[model samples]
Target: MQHSVQLTYDQNHSLSWGKFVGSVLFAFFGAQIISGLFIGLPFMIYTAGLSDKKTIALYSSLGNTGGTLLQLLILLLFIFKYEPIKKLLLPVLNFQALQKVRTYIYLFLFFGLSIAIHIFIISKLFPHATQEQDLALNLENLNQYKILLILGSAIFVPIFEELIFRGIILQFFQQRFPFWIAAIGSSFIFGIAHIYSLGVMVGAFMMGMFMAVLCKKTNSIIPAMLFHMMNNTLAFLS
Candidate 1:
C-alpha cells in the first residue's frame, strides 16, 4: 500500500530558517566530502601530490562528476518521503518545456545578464588573473579528461544544482516565506556553493535567481535545467 504524506506550510515554521540553512549547507559539503573520498581514495594510495597533468585531470573529472552524482542522490533522499513533488514536476517535461516561447525569453534575458555580469563584475573580481586565463589553464590541465569535465559541468552539475537550489531549497523556503524571499534565499546558497571562484560565485548568484524565477513561472524545473545546461556549456567552451 502507498501512503501520501502532506506537510503543511506553516506547521513547522519556527525552525524553518535553521532547517533551510542546515539542509543547504549539509547537502553542499556532504556532496563534496563524499565524492572526494569516493574518487580520492585511489590517488591517496599512490601519489602524494598531483604533479602529473593527466593525474590531475583524471582526478578533477572523476571527482567532480562523482560529486554531482552524490549531490543528486542526497537531494533525492531529502525529497524521497515527500510525495507531492512528482506532481509539480510531472506536468511540463515535454517538448513544450523546451519549445515554449517563454523558455527562450528567460534564456535570452539571463544570457544577456550573464554577459553584463562578466563584463562589469567578474572582470574586476579576478584576483590574480583573468577568468579567461583561468579557464584556458584548466582546459590545458584536463588533457584526456576534458570530455569528462564537460559532461560534468554542462550536464550533471546543472541538473543536480537546479534540483537542489531551485527545486528543493527554494520550495522549502517558500513554505515559510514569500516567493521573492524564497528565491533569493535559495539563490544565495547556490552562489555560495560555487565559492571556489569569485567570478563563478557572482555569476552563479545571478543565474540562480533567474532560474528560481523561471522554475516558479513555468511550474517545472525543466526550463531551468535547460538554461543551466546552456550556461555551463558556454562557460566551459569559453
Candidate 2:
C-alpha cells in the first residue's frame, strides 16, 4: 500500500500539461510585471523633476539592463522550482548530441537554409520587413549600457529562449503529437513573440522552425543555443 502511494505521489509531482502551460505564462508575465513595477517605476521616479535629457537616457539604459536581469531571474526560478523541469535540463545540456559528425553537418545545413529563407524569400517578398526591433541600433542607442545590453540580447536571450521554446514547449507537445505538429506549434508561438510586420514574422517563423529541427536532430538543446548565439552575434556585428 505504501509503495503504491509513493508511486502516486511521484506521478503527481511530475510536470503535467497544465503545469507546463502555467509555467510558460508565469515566466513571461512575471518578468513583465517585475520589470514594470521594480525597474521602470523606480527609474521614472528617479528621473522626475530632472529635465536633463541625459538623465532621461541614463534612466532608460539602467531600466533596460535591470529588466533583462529580472527576466532571466524569473525564468531560472520557474525552471529550478520544478523537479521534472530540472530533469529536462540534463538532456537539454547533453554533450553526447554533438558526438556525431552528421549533427554538425545538419547544424550548418539548417542554419544556412534558414538564412536563405529569411533573406531571399521573406525579405524579398516584403521589402520593408525587419526584426521586431533593430537590435544592433538599440544597443548603439543605449551605448551607455552596451555591455549589459549585448549580454542580455545576445547571450541570455538565447539561453532562456531555447530552454523555454524548444526545451519545454516543443518537447512537451512532441510527446503526444506528431513531429510536424509539435514543431509548428512551438515555432508559431516563437515567431509570434517577435511579431511586428508580416515579413519579420515569417522570417522569425522560419528561424524557429530551423531551431526546432536542430534540437530534434541532435536530441538536445545545446546545439540550438549555439546556433542562436552565433546568429545573434553576427547580426550585431553586421
Candidate 3:
C-alpha cells in the first residue's frame, strides 16, 4: 500500500512540473503575439497617413521592442516565483562568463563564416531562391533609425529570445528528455517563431541548433546570447 501511494505521489509531482513548464511556454508565446498586435496596430493606424518606408520601419521596430519587453516582463515574473527558474537563470548572468570575450569573438567569426559559406553555396545551386531583395528593402529603411535599430536588434532581441528559447524552454525539456531531443525540439520551435520565408526558416533552424549547441557546451545561455547579438548586429549592418 505504501509503495503504491508513493508511486502515485511521484506521478502527480511529475505531472505538475510538466504543466508548469507548459504554462510558461504558452504564456511567453501568447503574450508576445498579443502584445505585438496590441502595440503594432496603433502604430500602423497612426502612420497610415505618413506611408513612408522609414516611418513604417521605425514603428515596426517600436512594436517589436514593446512585444519583447512584454516577454521579458513575463519571464521575470516566472524567474522570481520559481526557484528552479531562478537557479537556471542566475548562472547565465554571471559576470565571469562575460569576461570570455575572445571565446565569443571566435564563436562569432566561426559561425558567421560558416553560415555565409552555406548561403553562398545554396545561392549558387538555387539562383532564384535568394531573399536578399526583401531583406535589403527592410534593412535599408532602418538607416534613419540606426541607433534604435541597433539596440533593438542587437541587444534586446537576443536577450529576450535566448532567455526564452535556450534558458527556459530548452532547459526545461532537457530535464525531462535527452539532450538531442531537447535541443532539436526547442530549435524547431525557435525556427517556427521567426515565421520567415522558407529559406529564412531553414537558416533560422540551423542558427537555432547552433545556439542550442553553444548553450549545451558552455552550460550557460550567455554565450549563445552574445553570438545571437553579434549575428543580428551584422545582419542589420549588412
**After superposing candidate 3, which stretches have Cα over 4 Å from the reference?**
1-21, 24-27, 51-57, 82-84, 91-95, 100-106, 109-113, 120-140
lDDT of 3 by residue, 84-192 (tens): 5666567665546556765576567658765685577645654543355346446555556777777877787788788788877787678678999999998898877
Candidate number achieving the greatest lDDT relative to the actual structure: 2
Give the clashing pairs for model 1.
Answer: none
Please give the clash total of every predicted structure, in order: 0, 0, 0
State every prediction's TM-score relative to the real structure: 0.73, 0.82, 0.76
- Candidate 1: regions farther than 4 A off: 1-9, 12-22, 44-52, 81-96, 124-140
Residue 72's lDDT within candidate 1 is 70
lDDT of 1 at 62: 71
What local lDDT score does residue 104 receive in model 1, on the 0 to 100 scale? 77
Name the candidate, 1 or 2, with the larger TM-score value: 2
Q: Across residues 74-184, which tens digit of lDDT does each residue of candidate 2 receive? A: 778878877777765656677888888988898889888877876778878987665445652355446565665567667887887888888888887776689989999
Number of clashing pairs, model 3? 0
Stronger candidate by lDDT (1 vs 3): 3
Q: What clash count does candidate 2 reach?
A: 0
lDDT of 1 by residue, 21-68 (tens): 666565567666776676656545444575886676677667666666
Model 2: lDDT to the true structure: 0.76
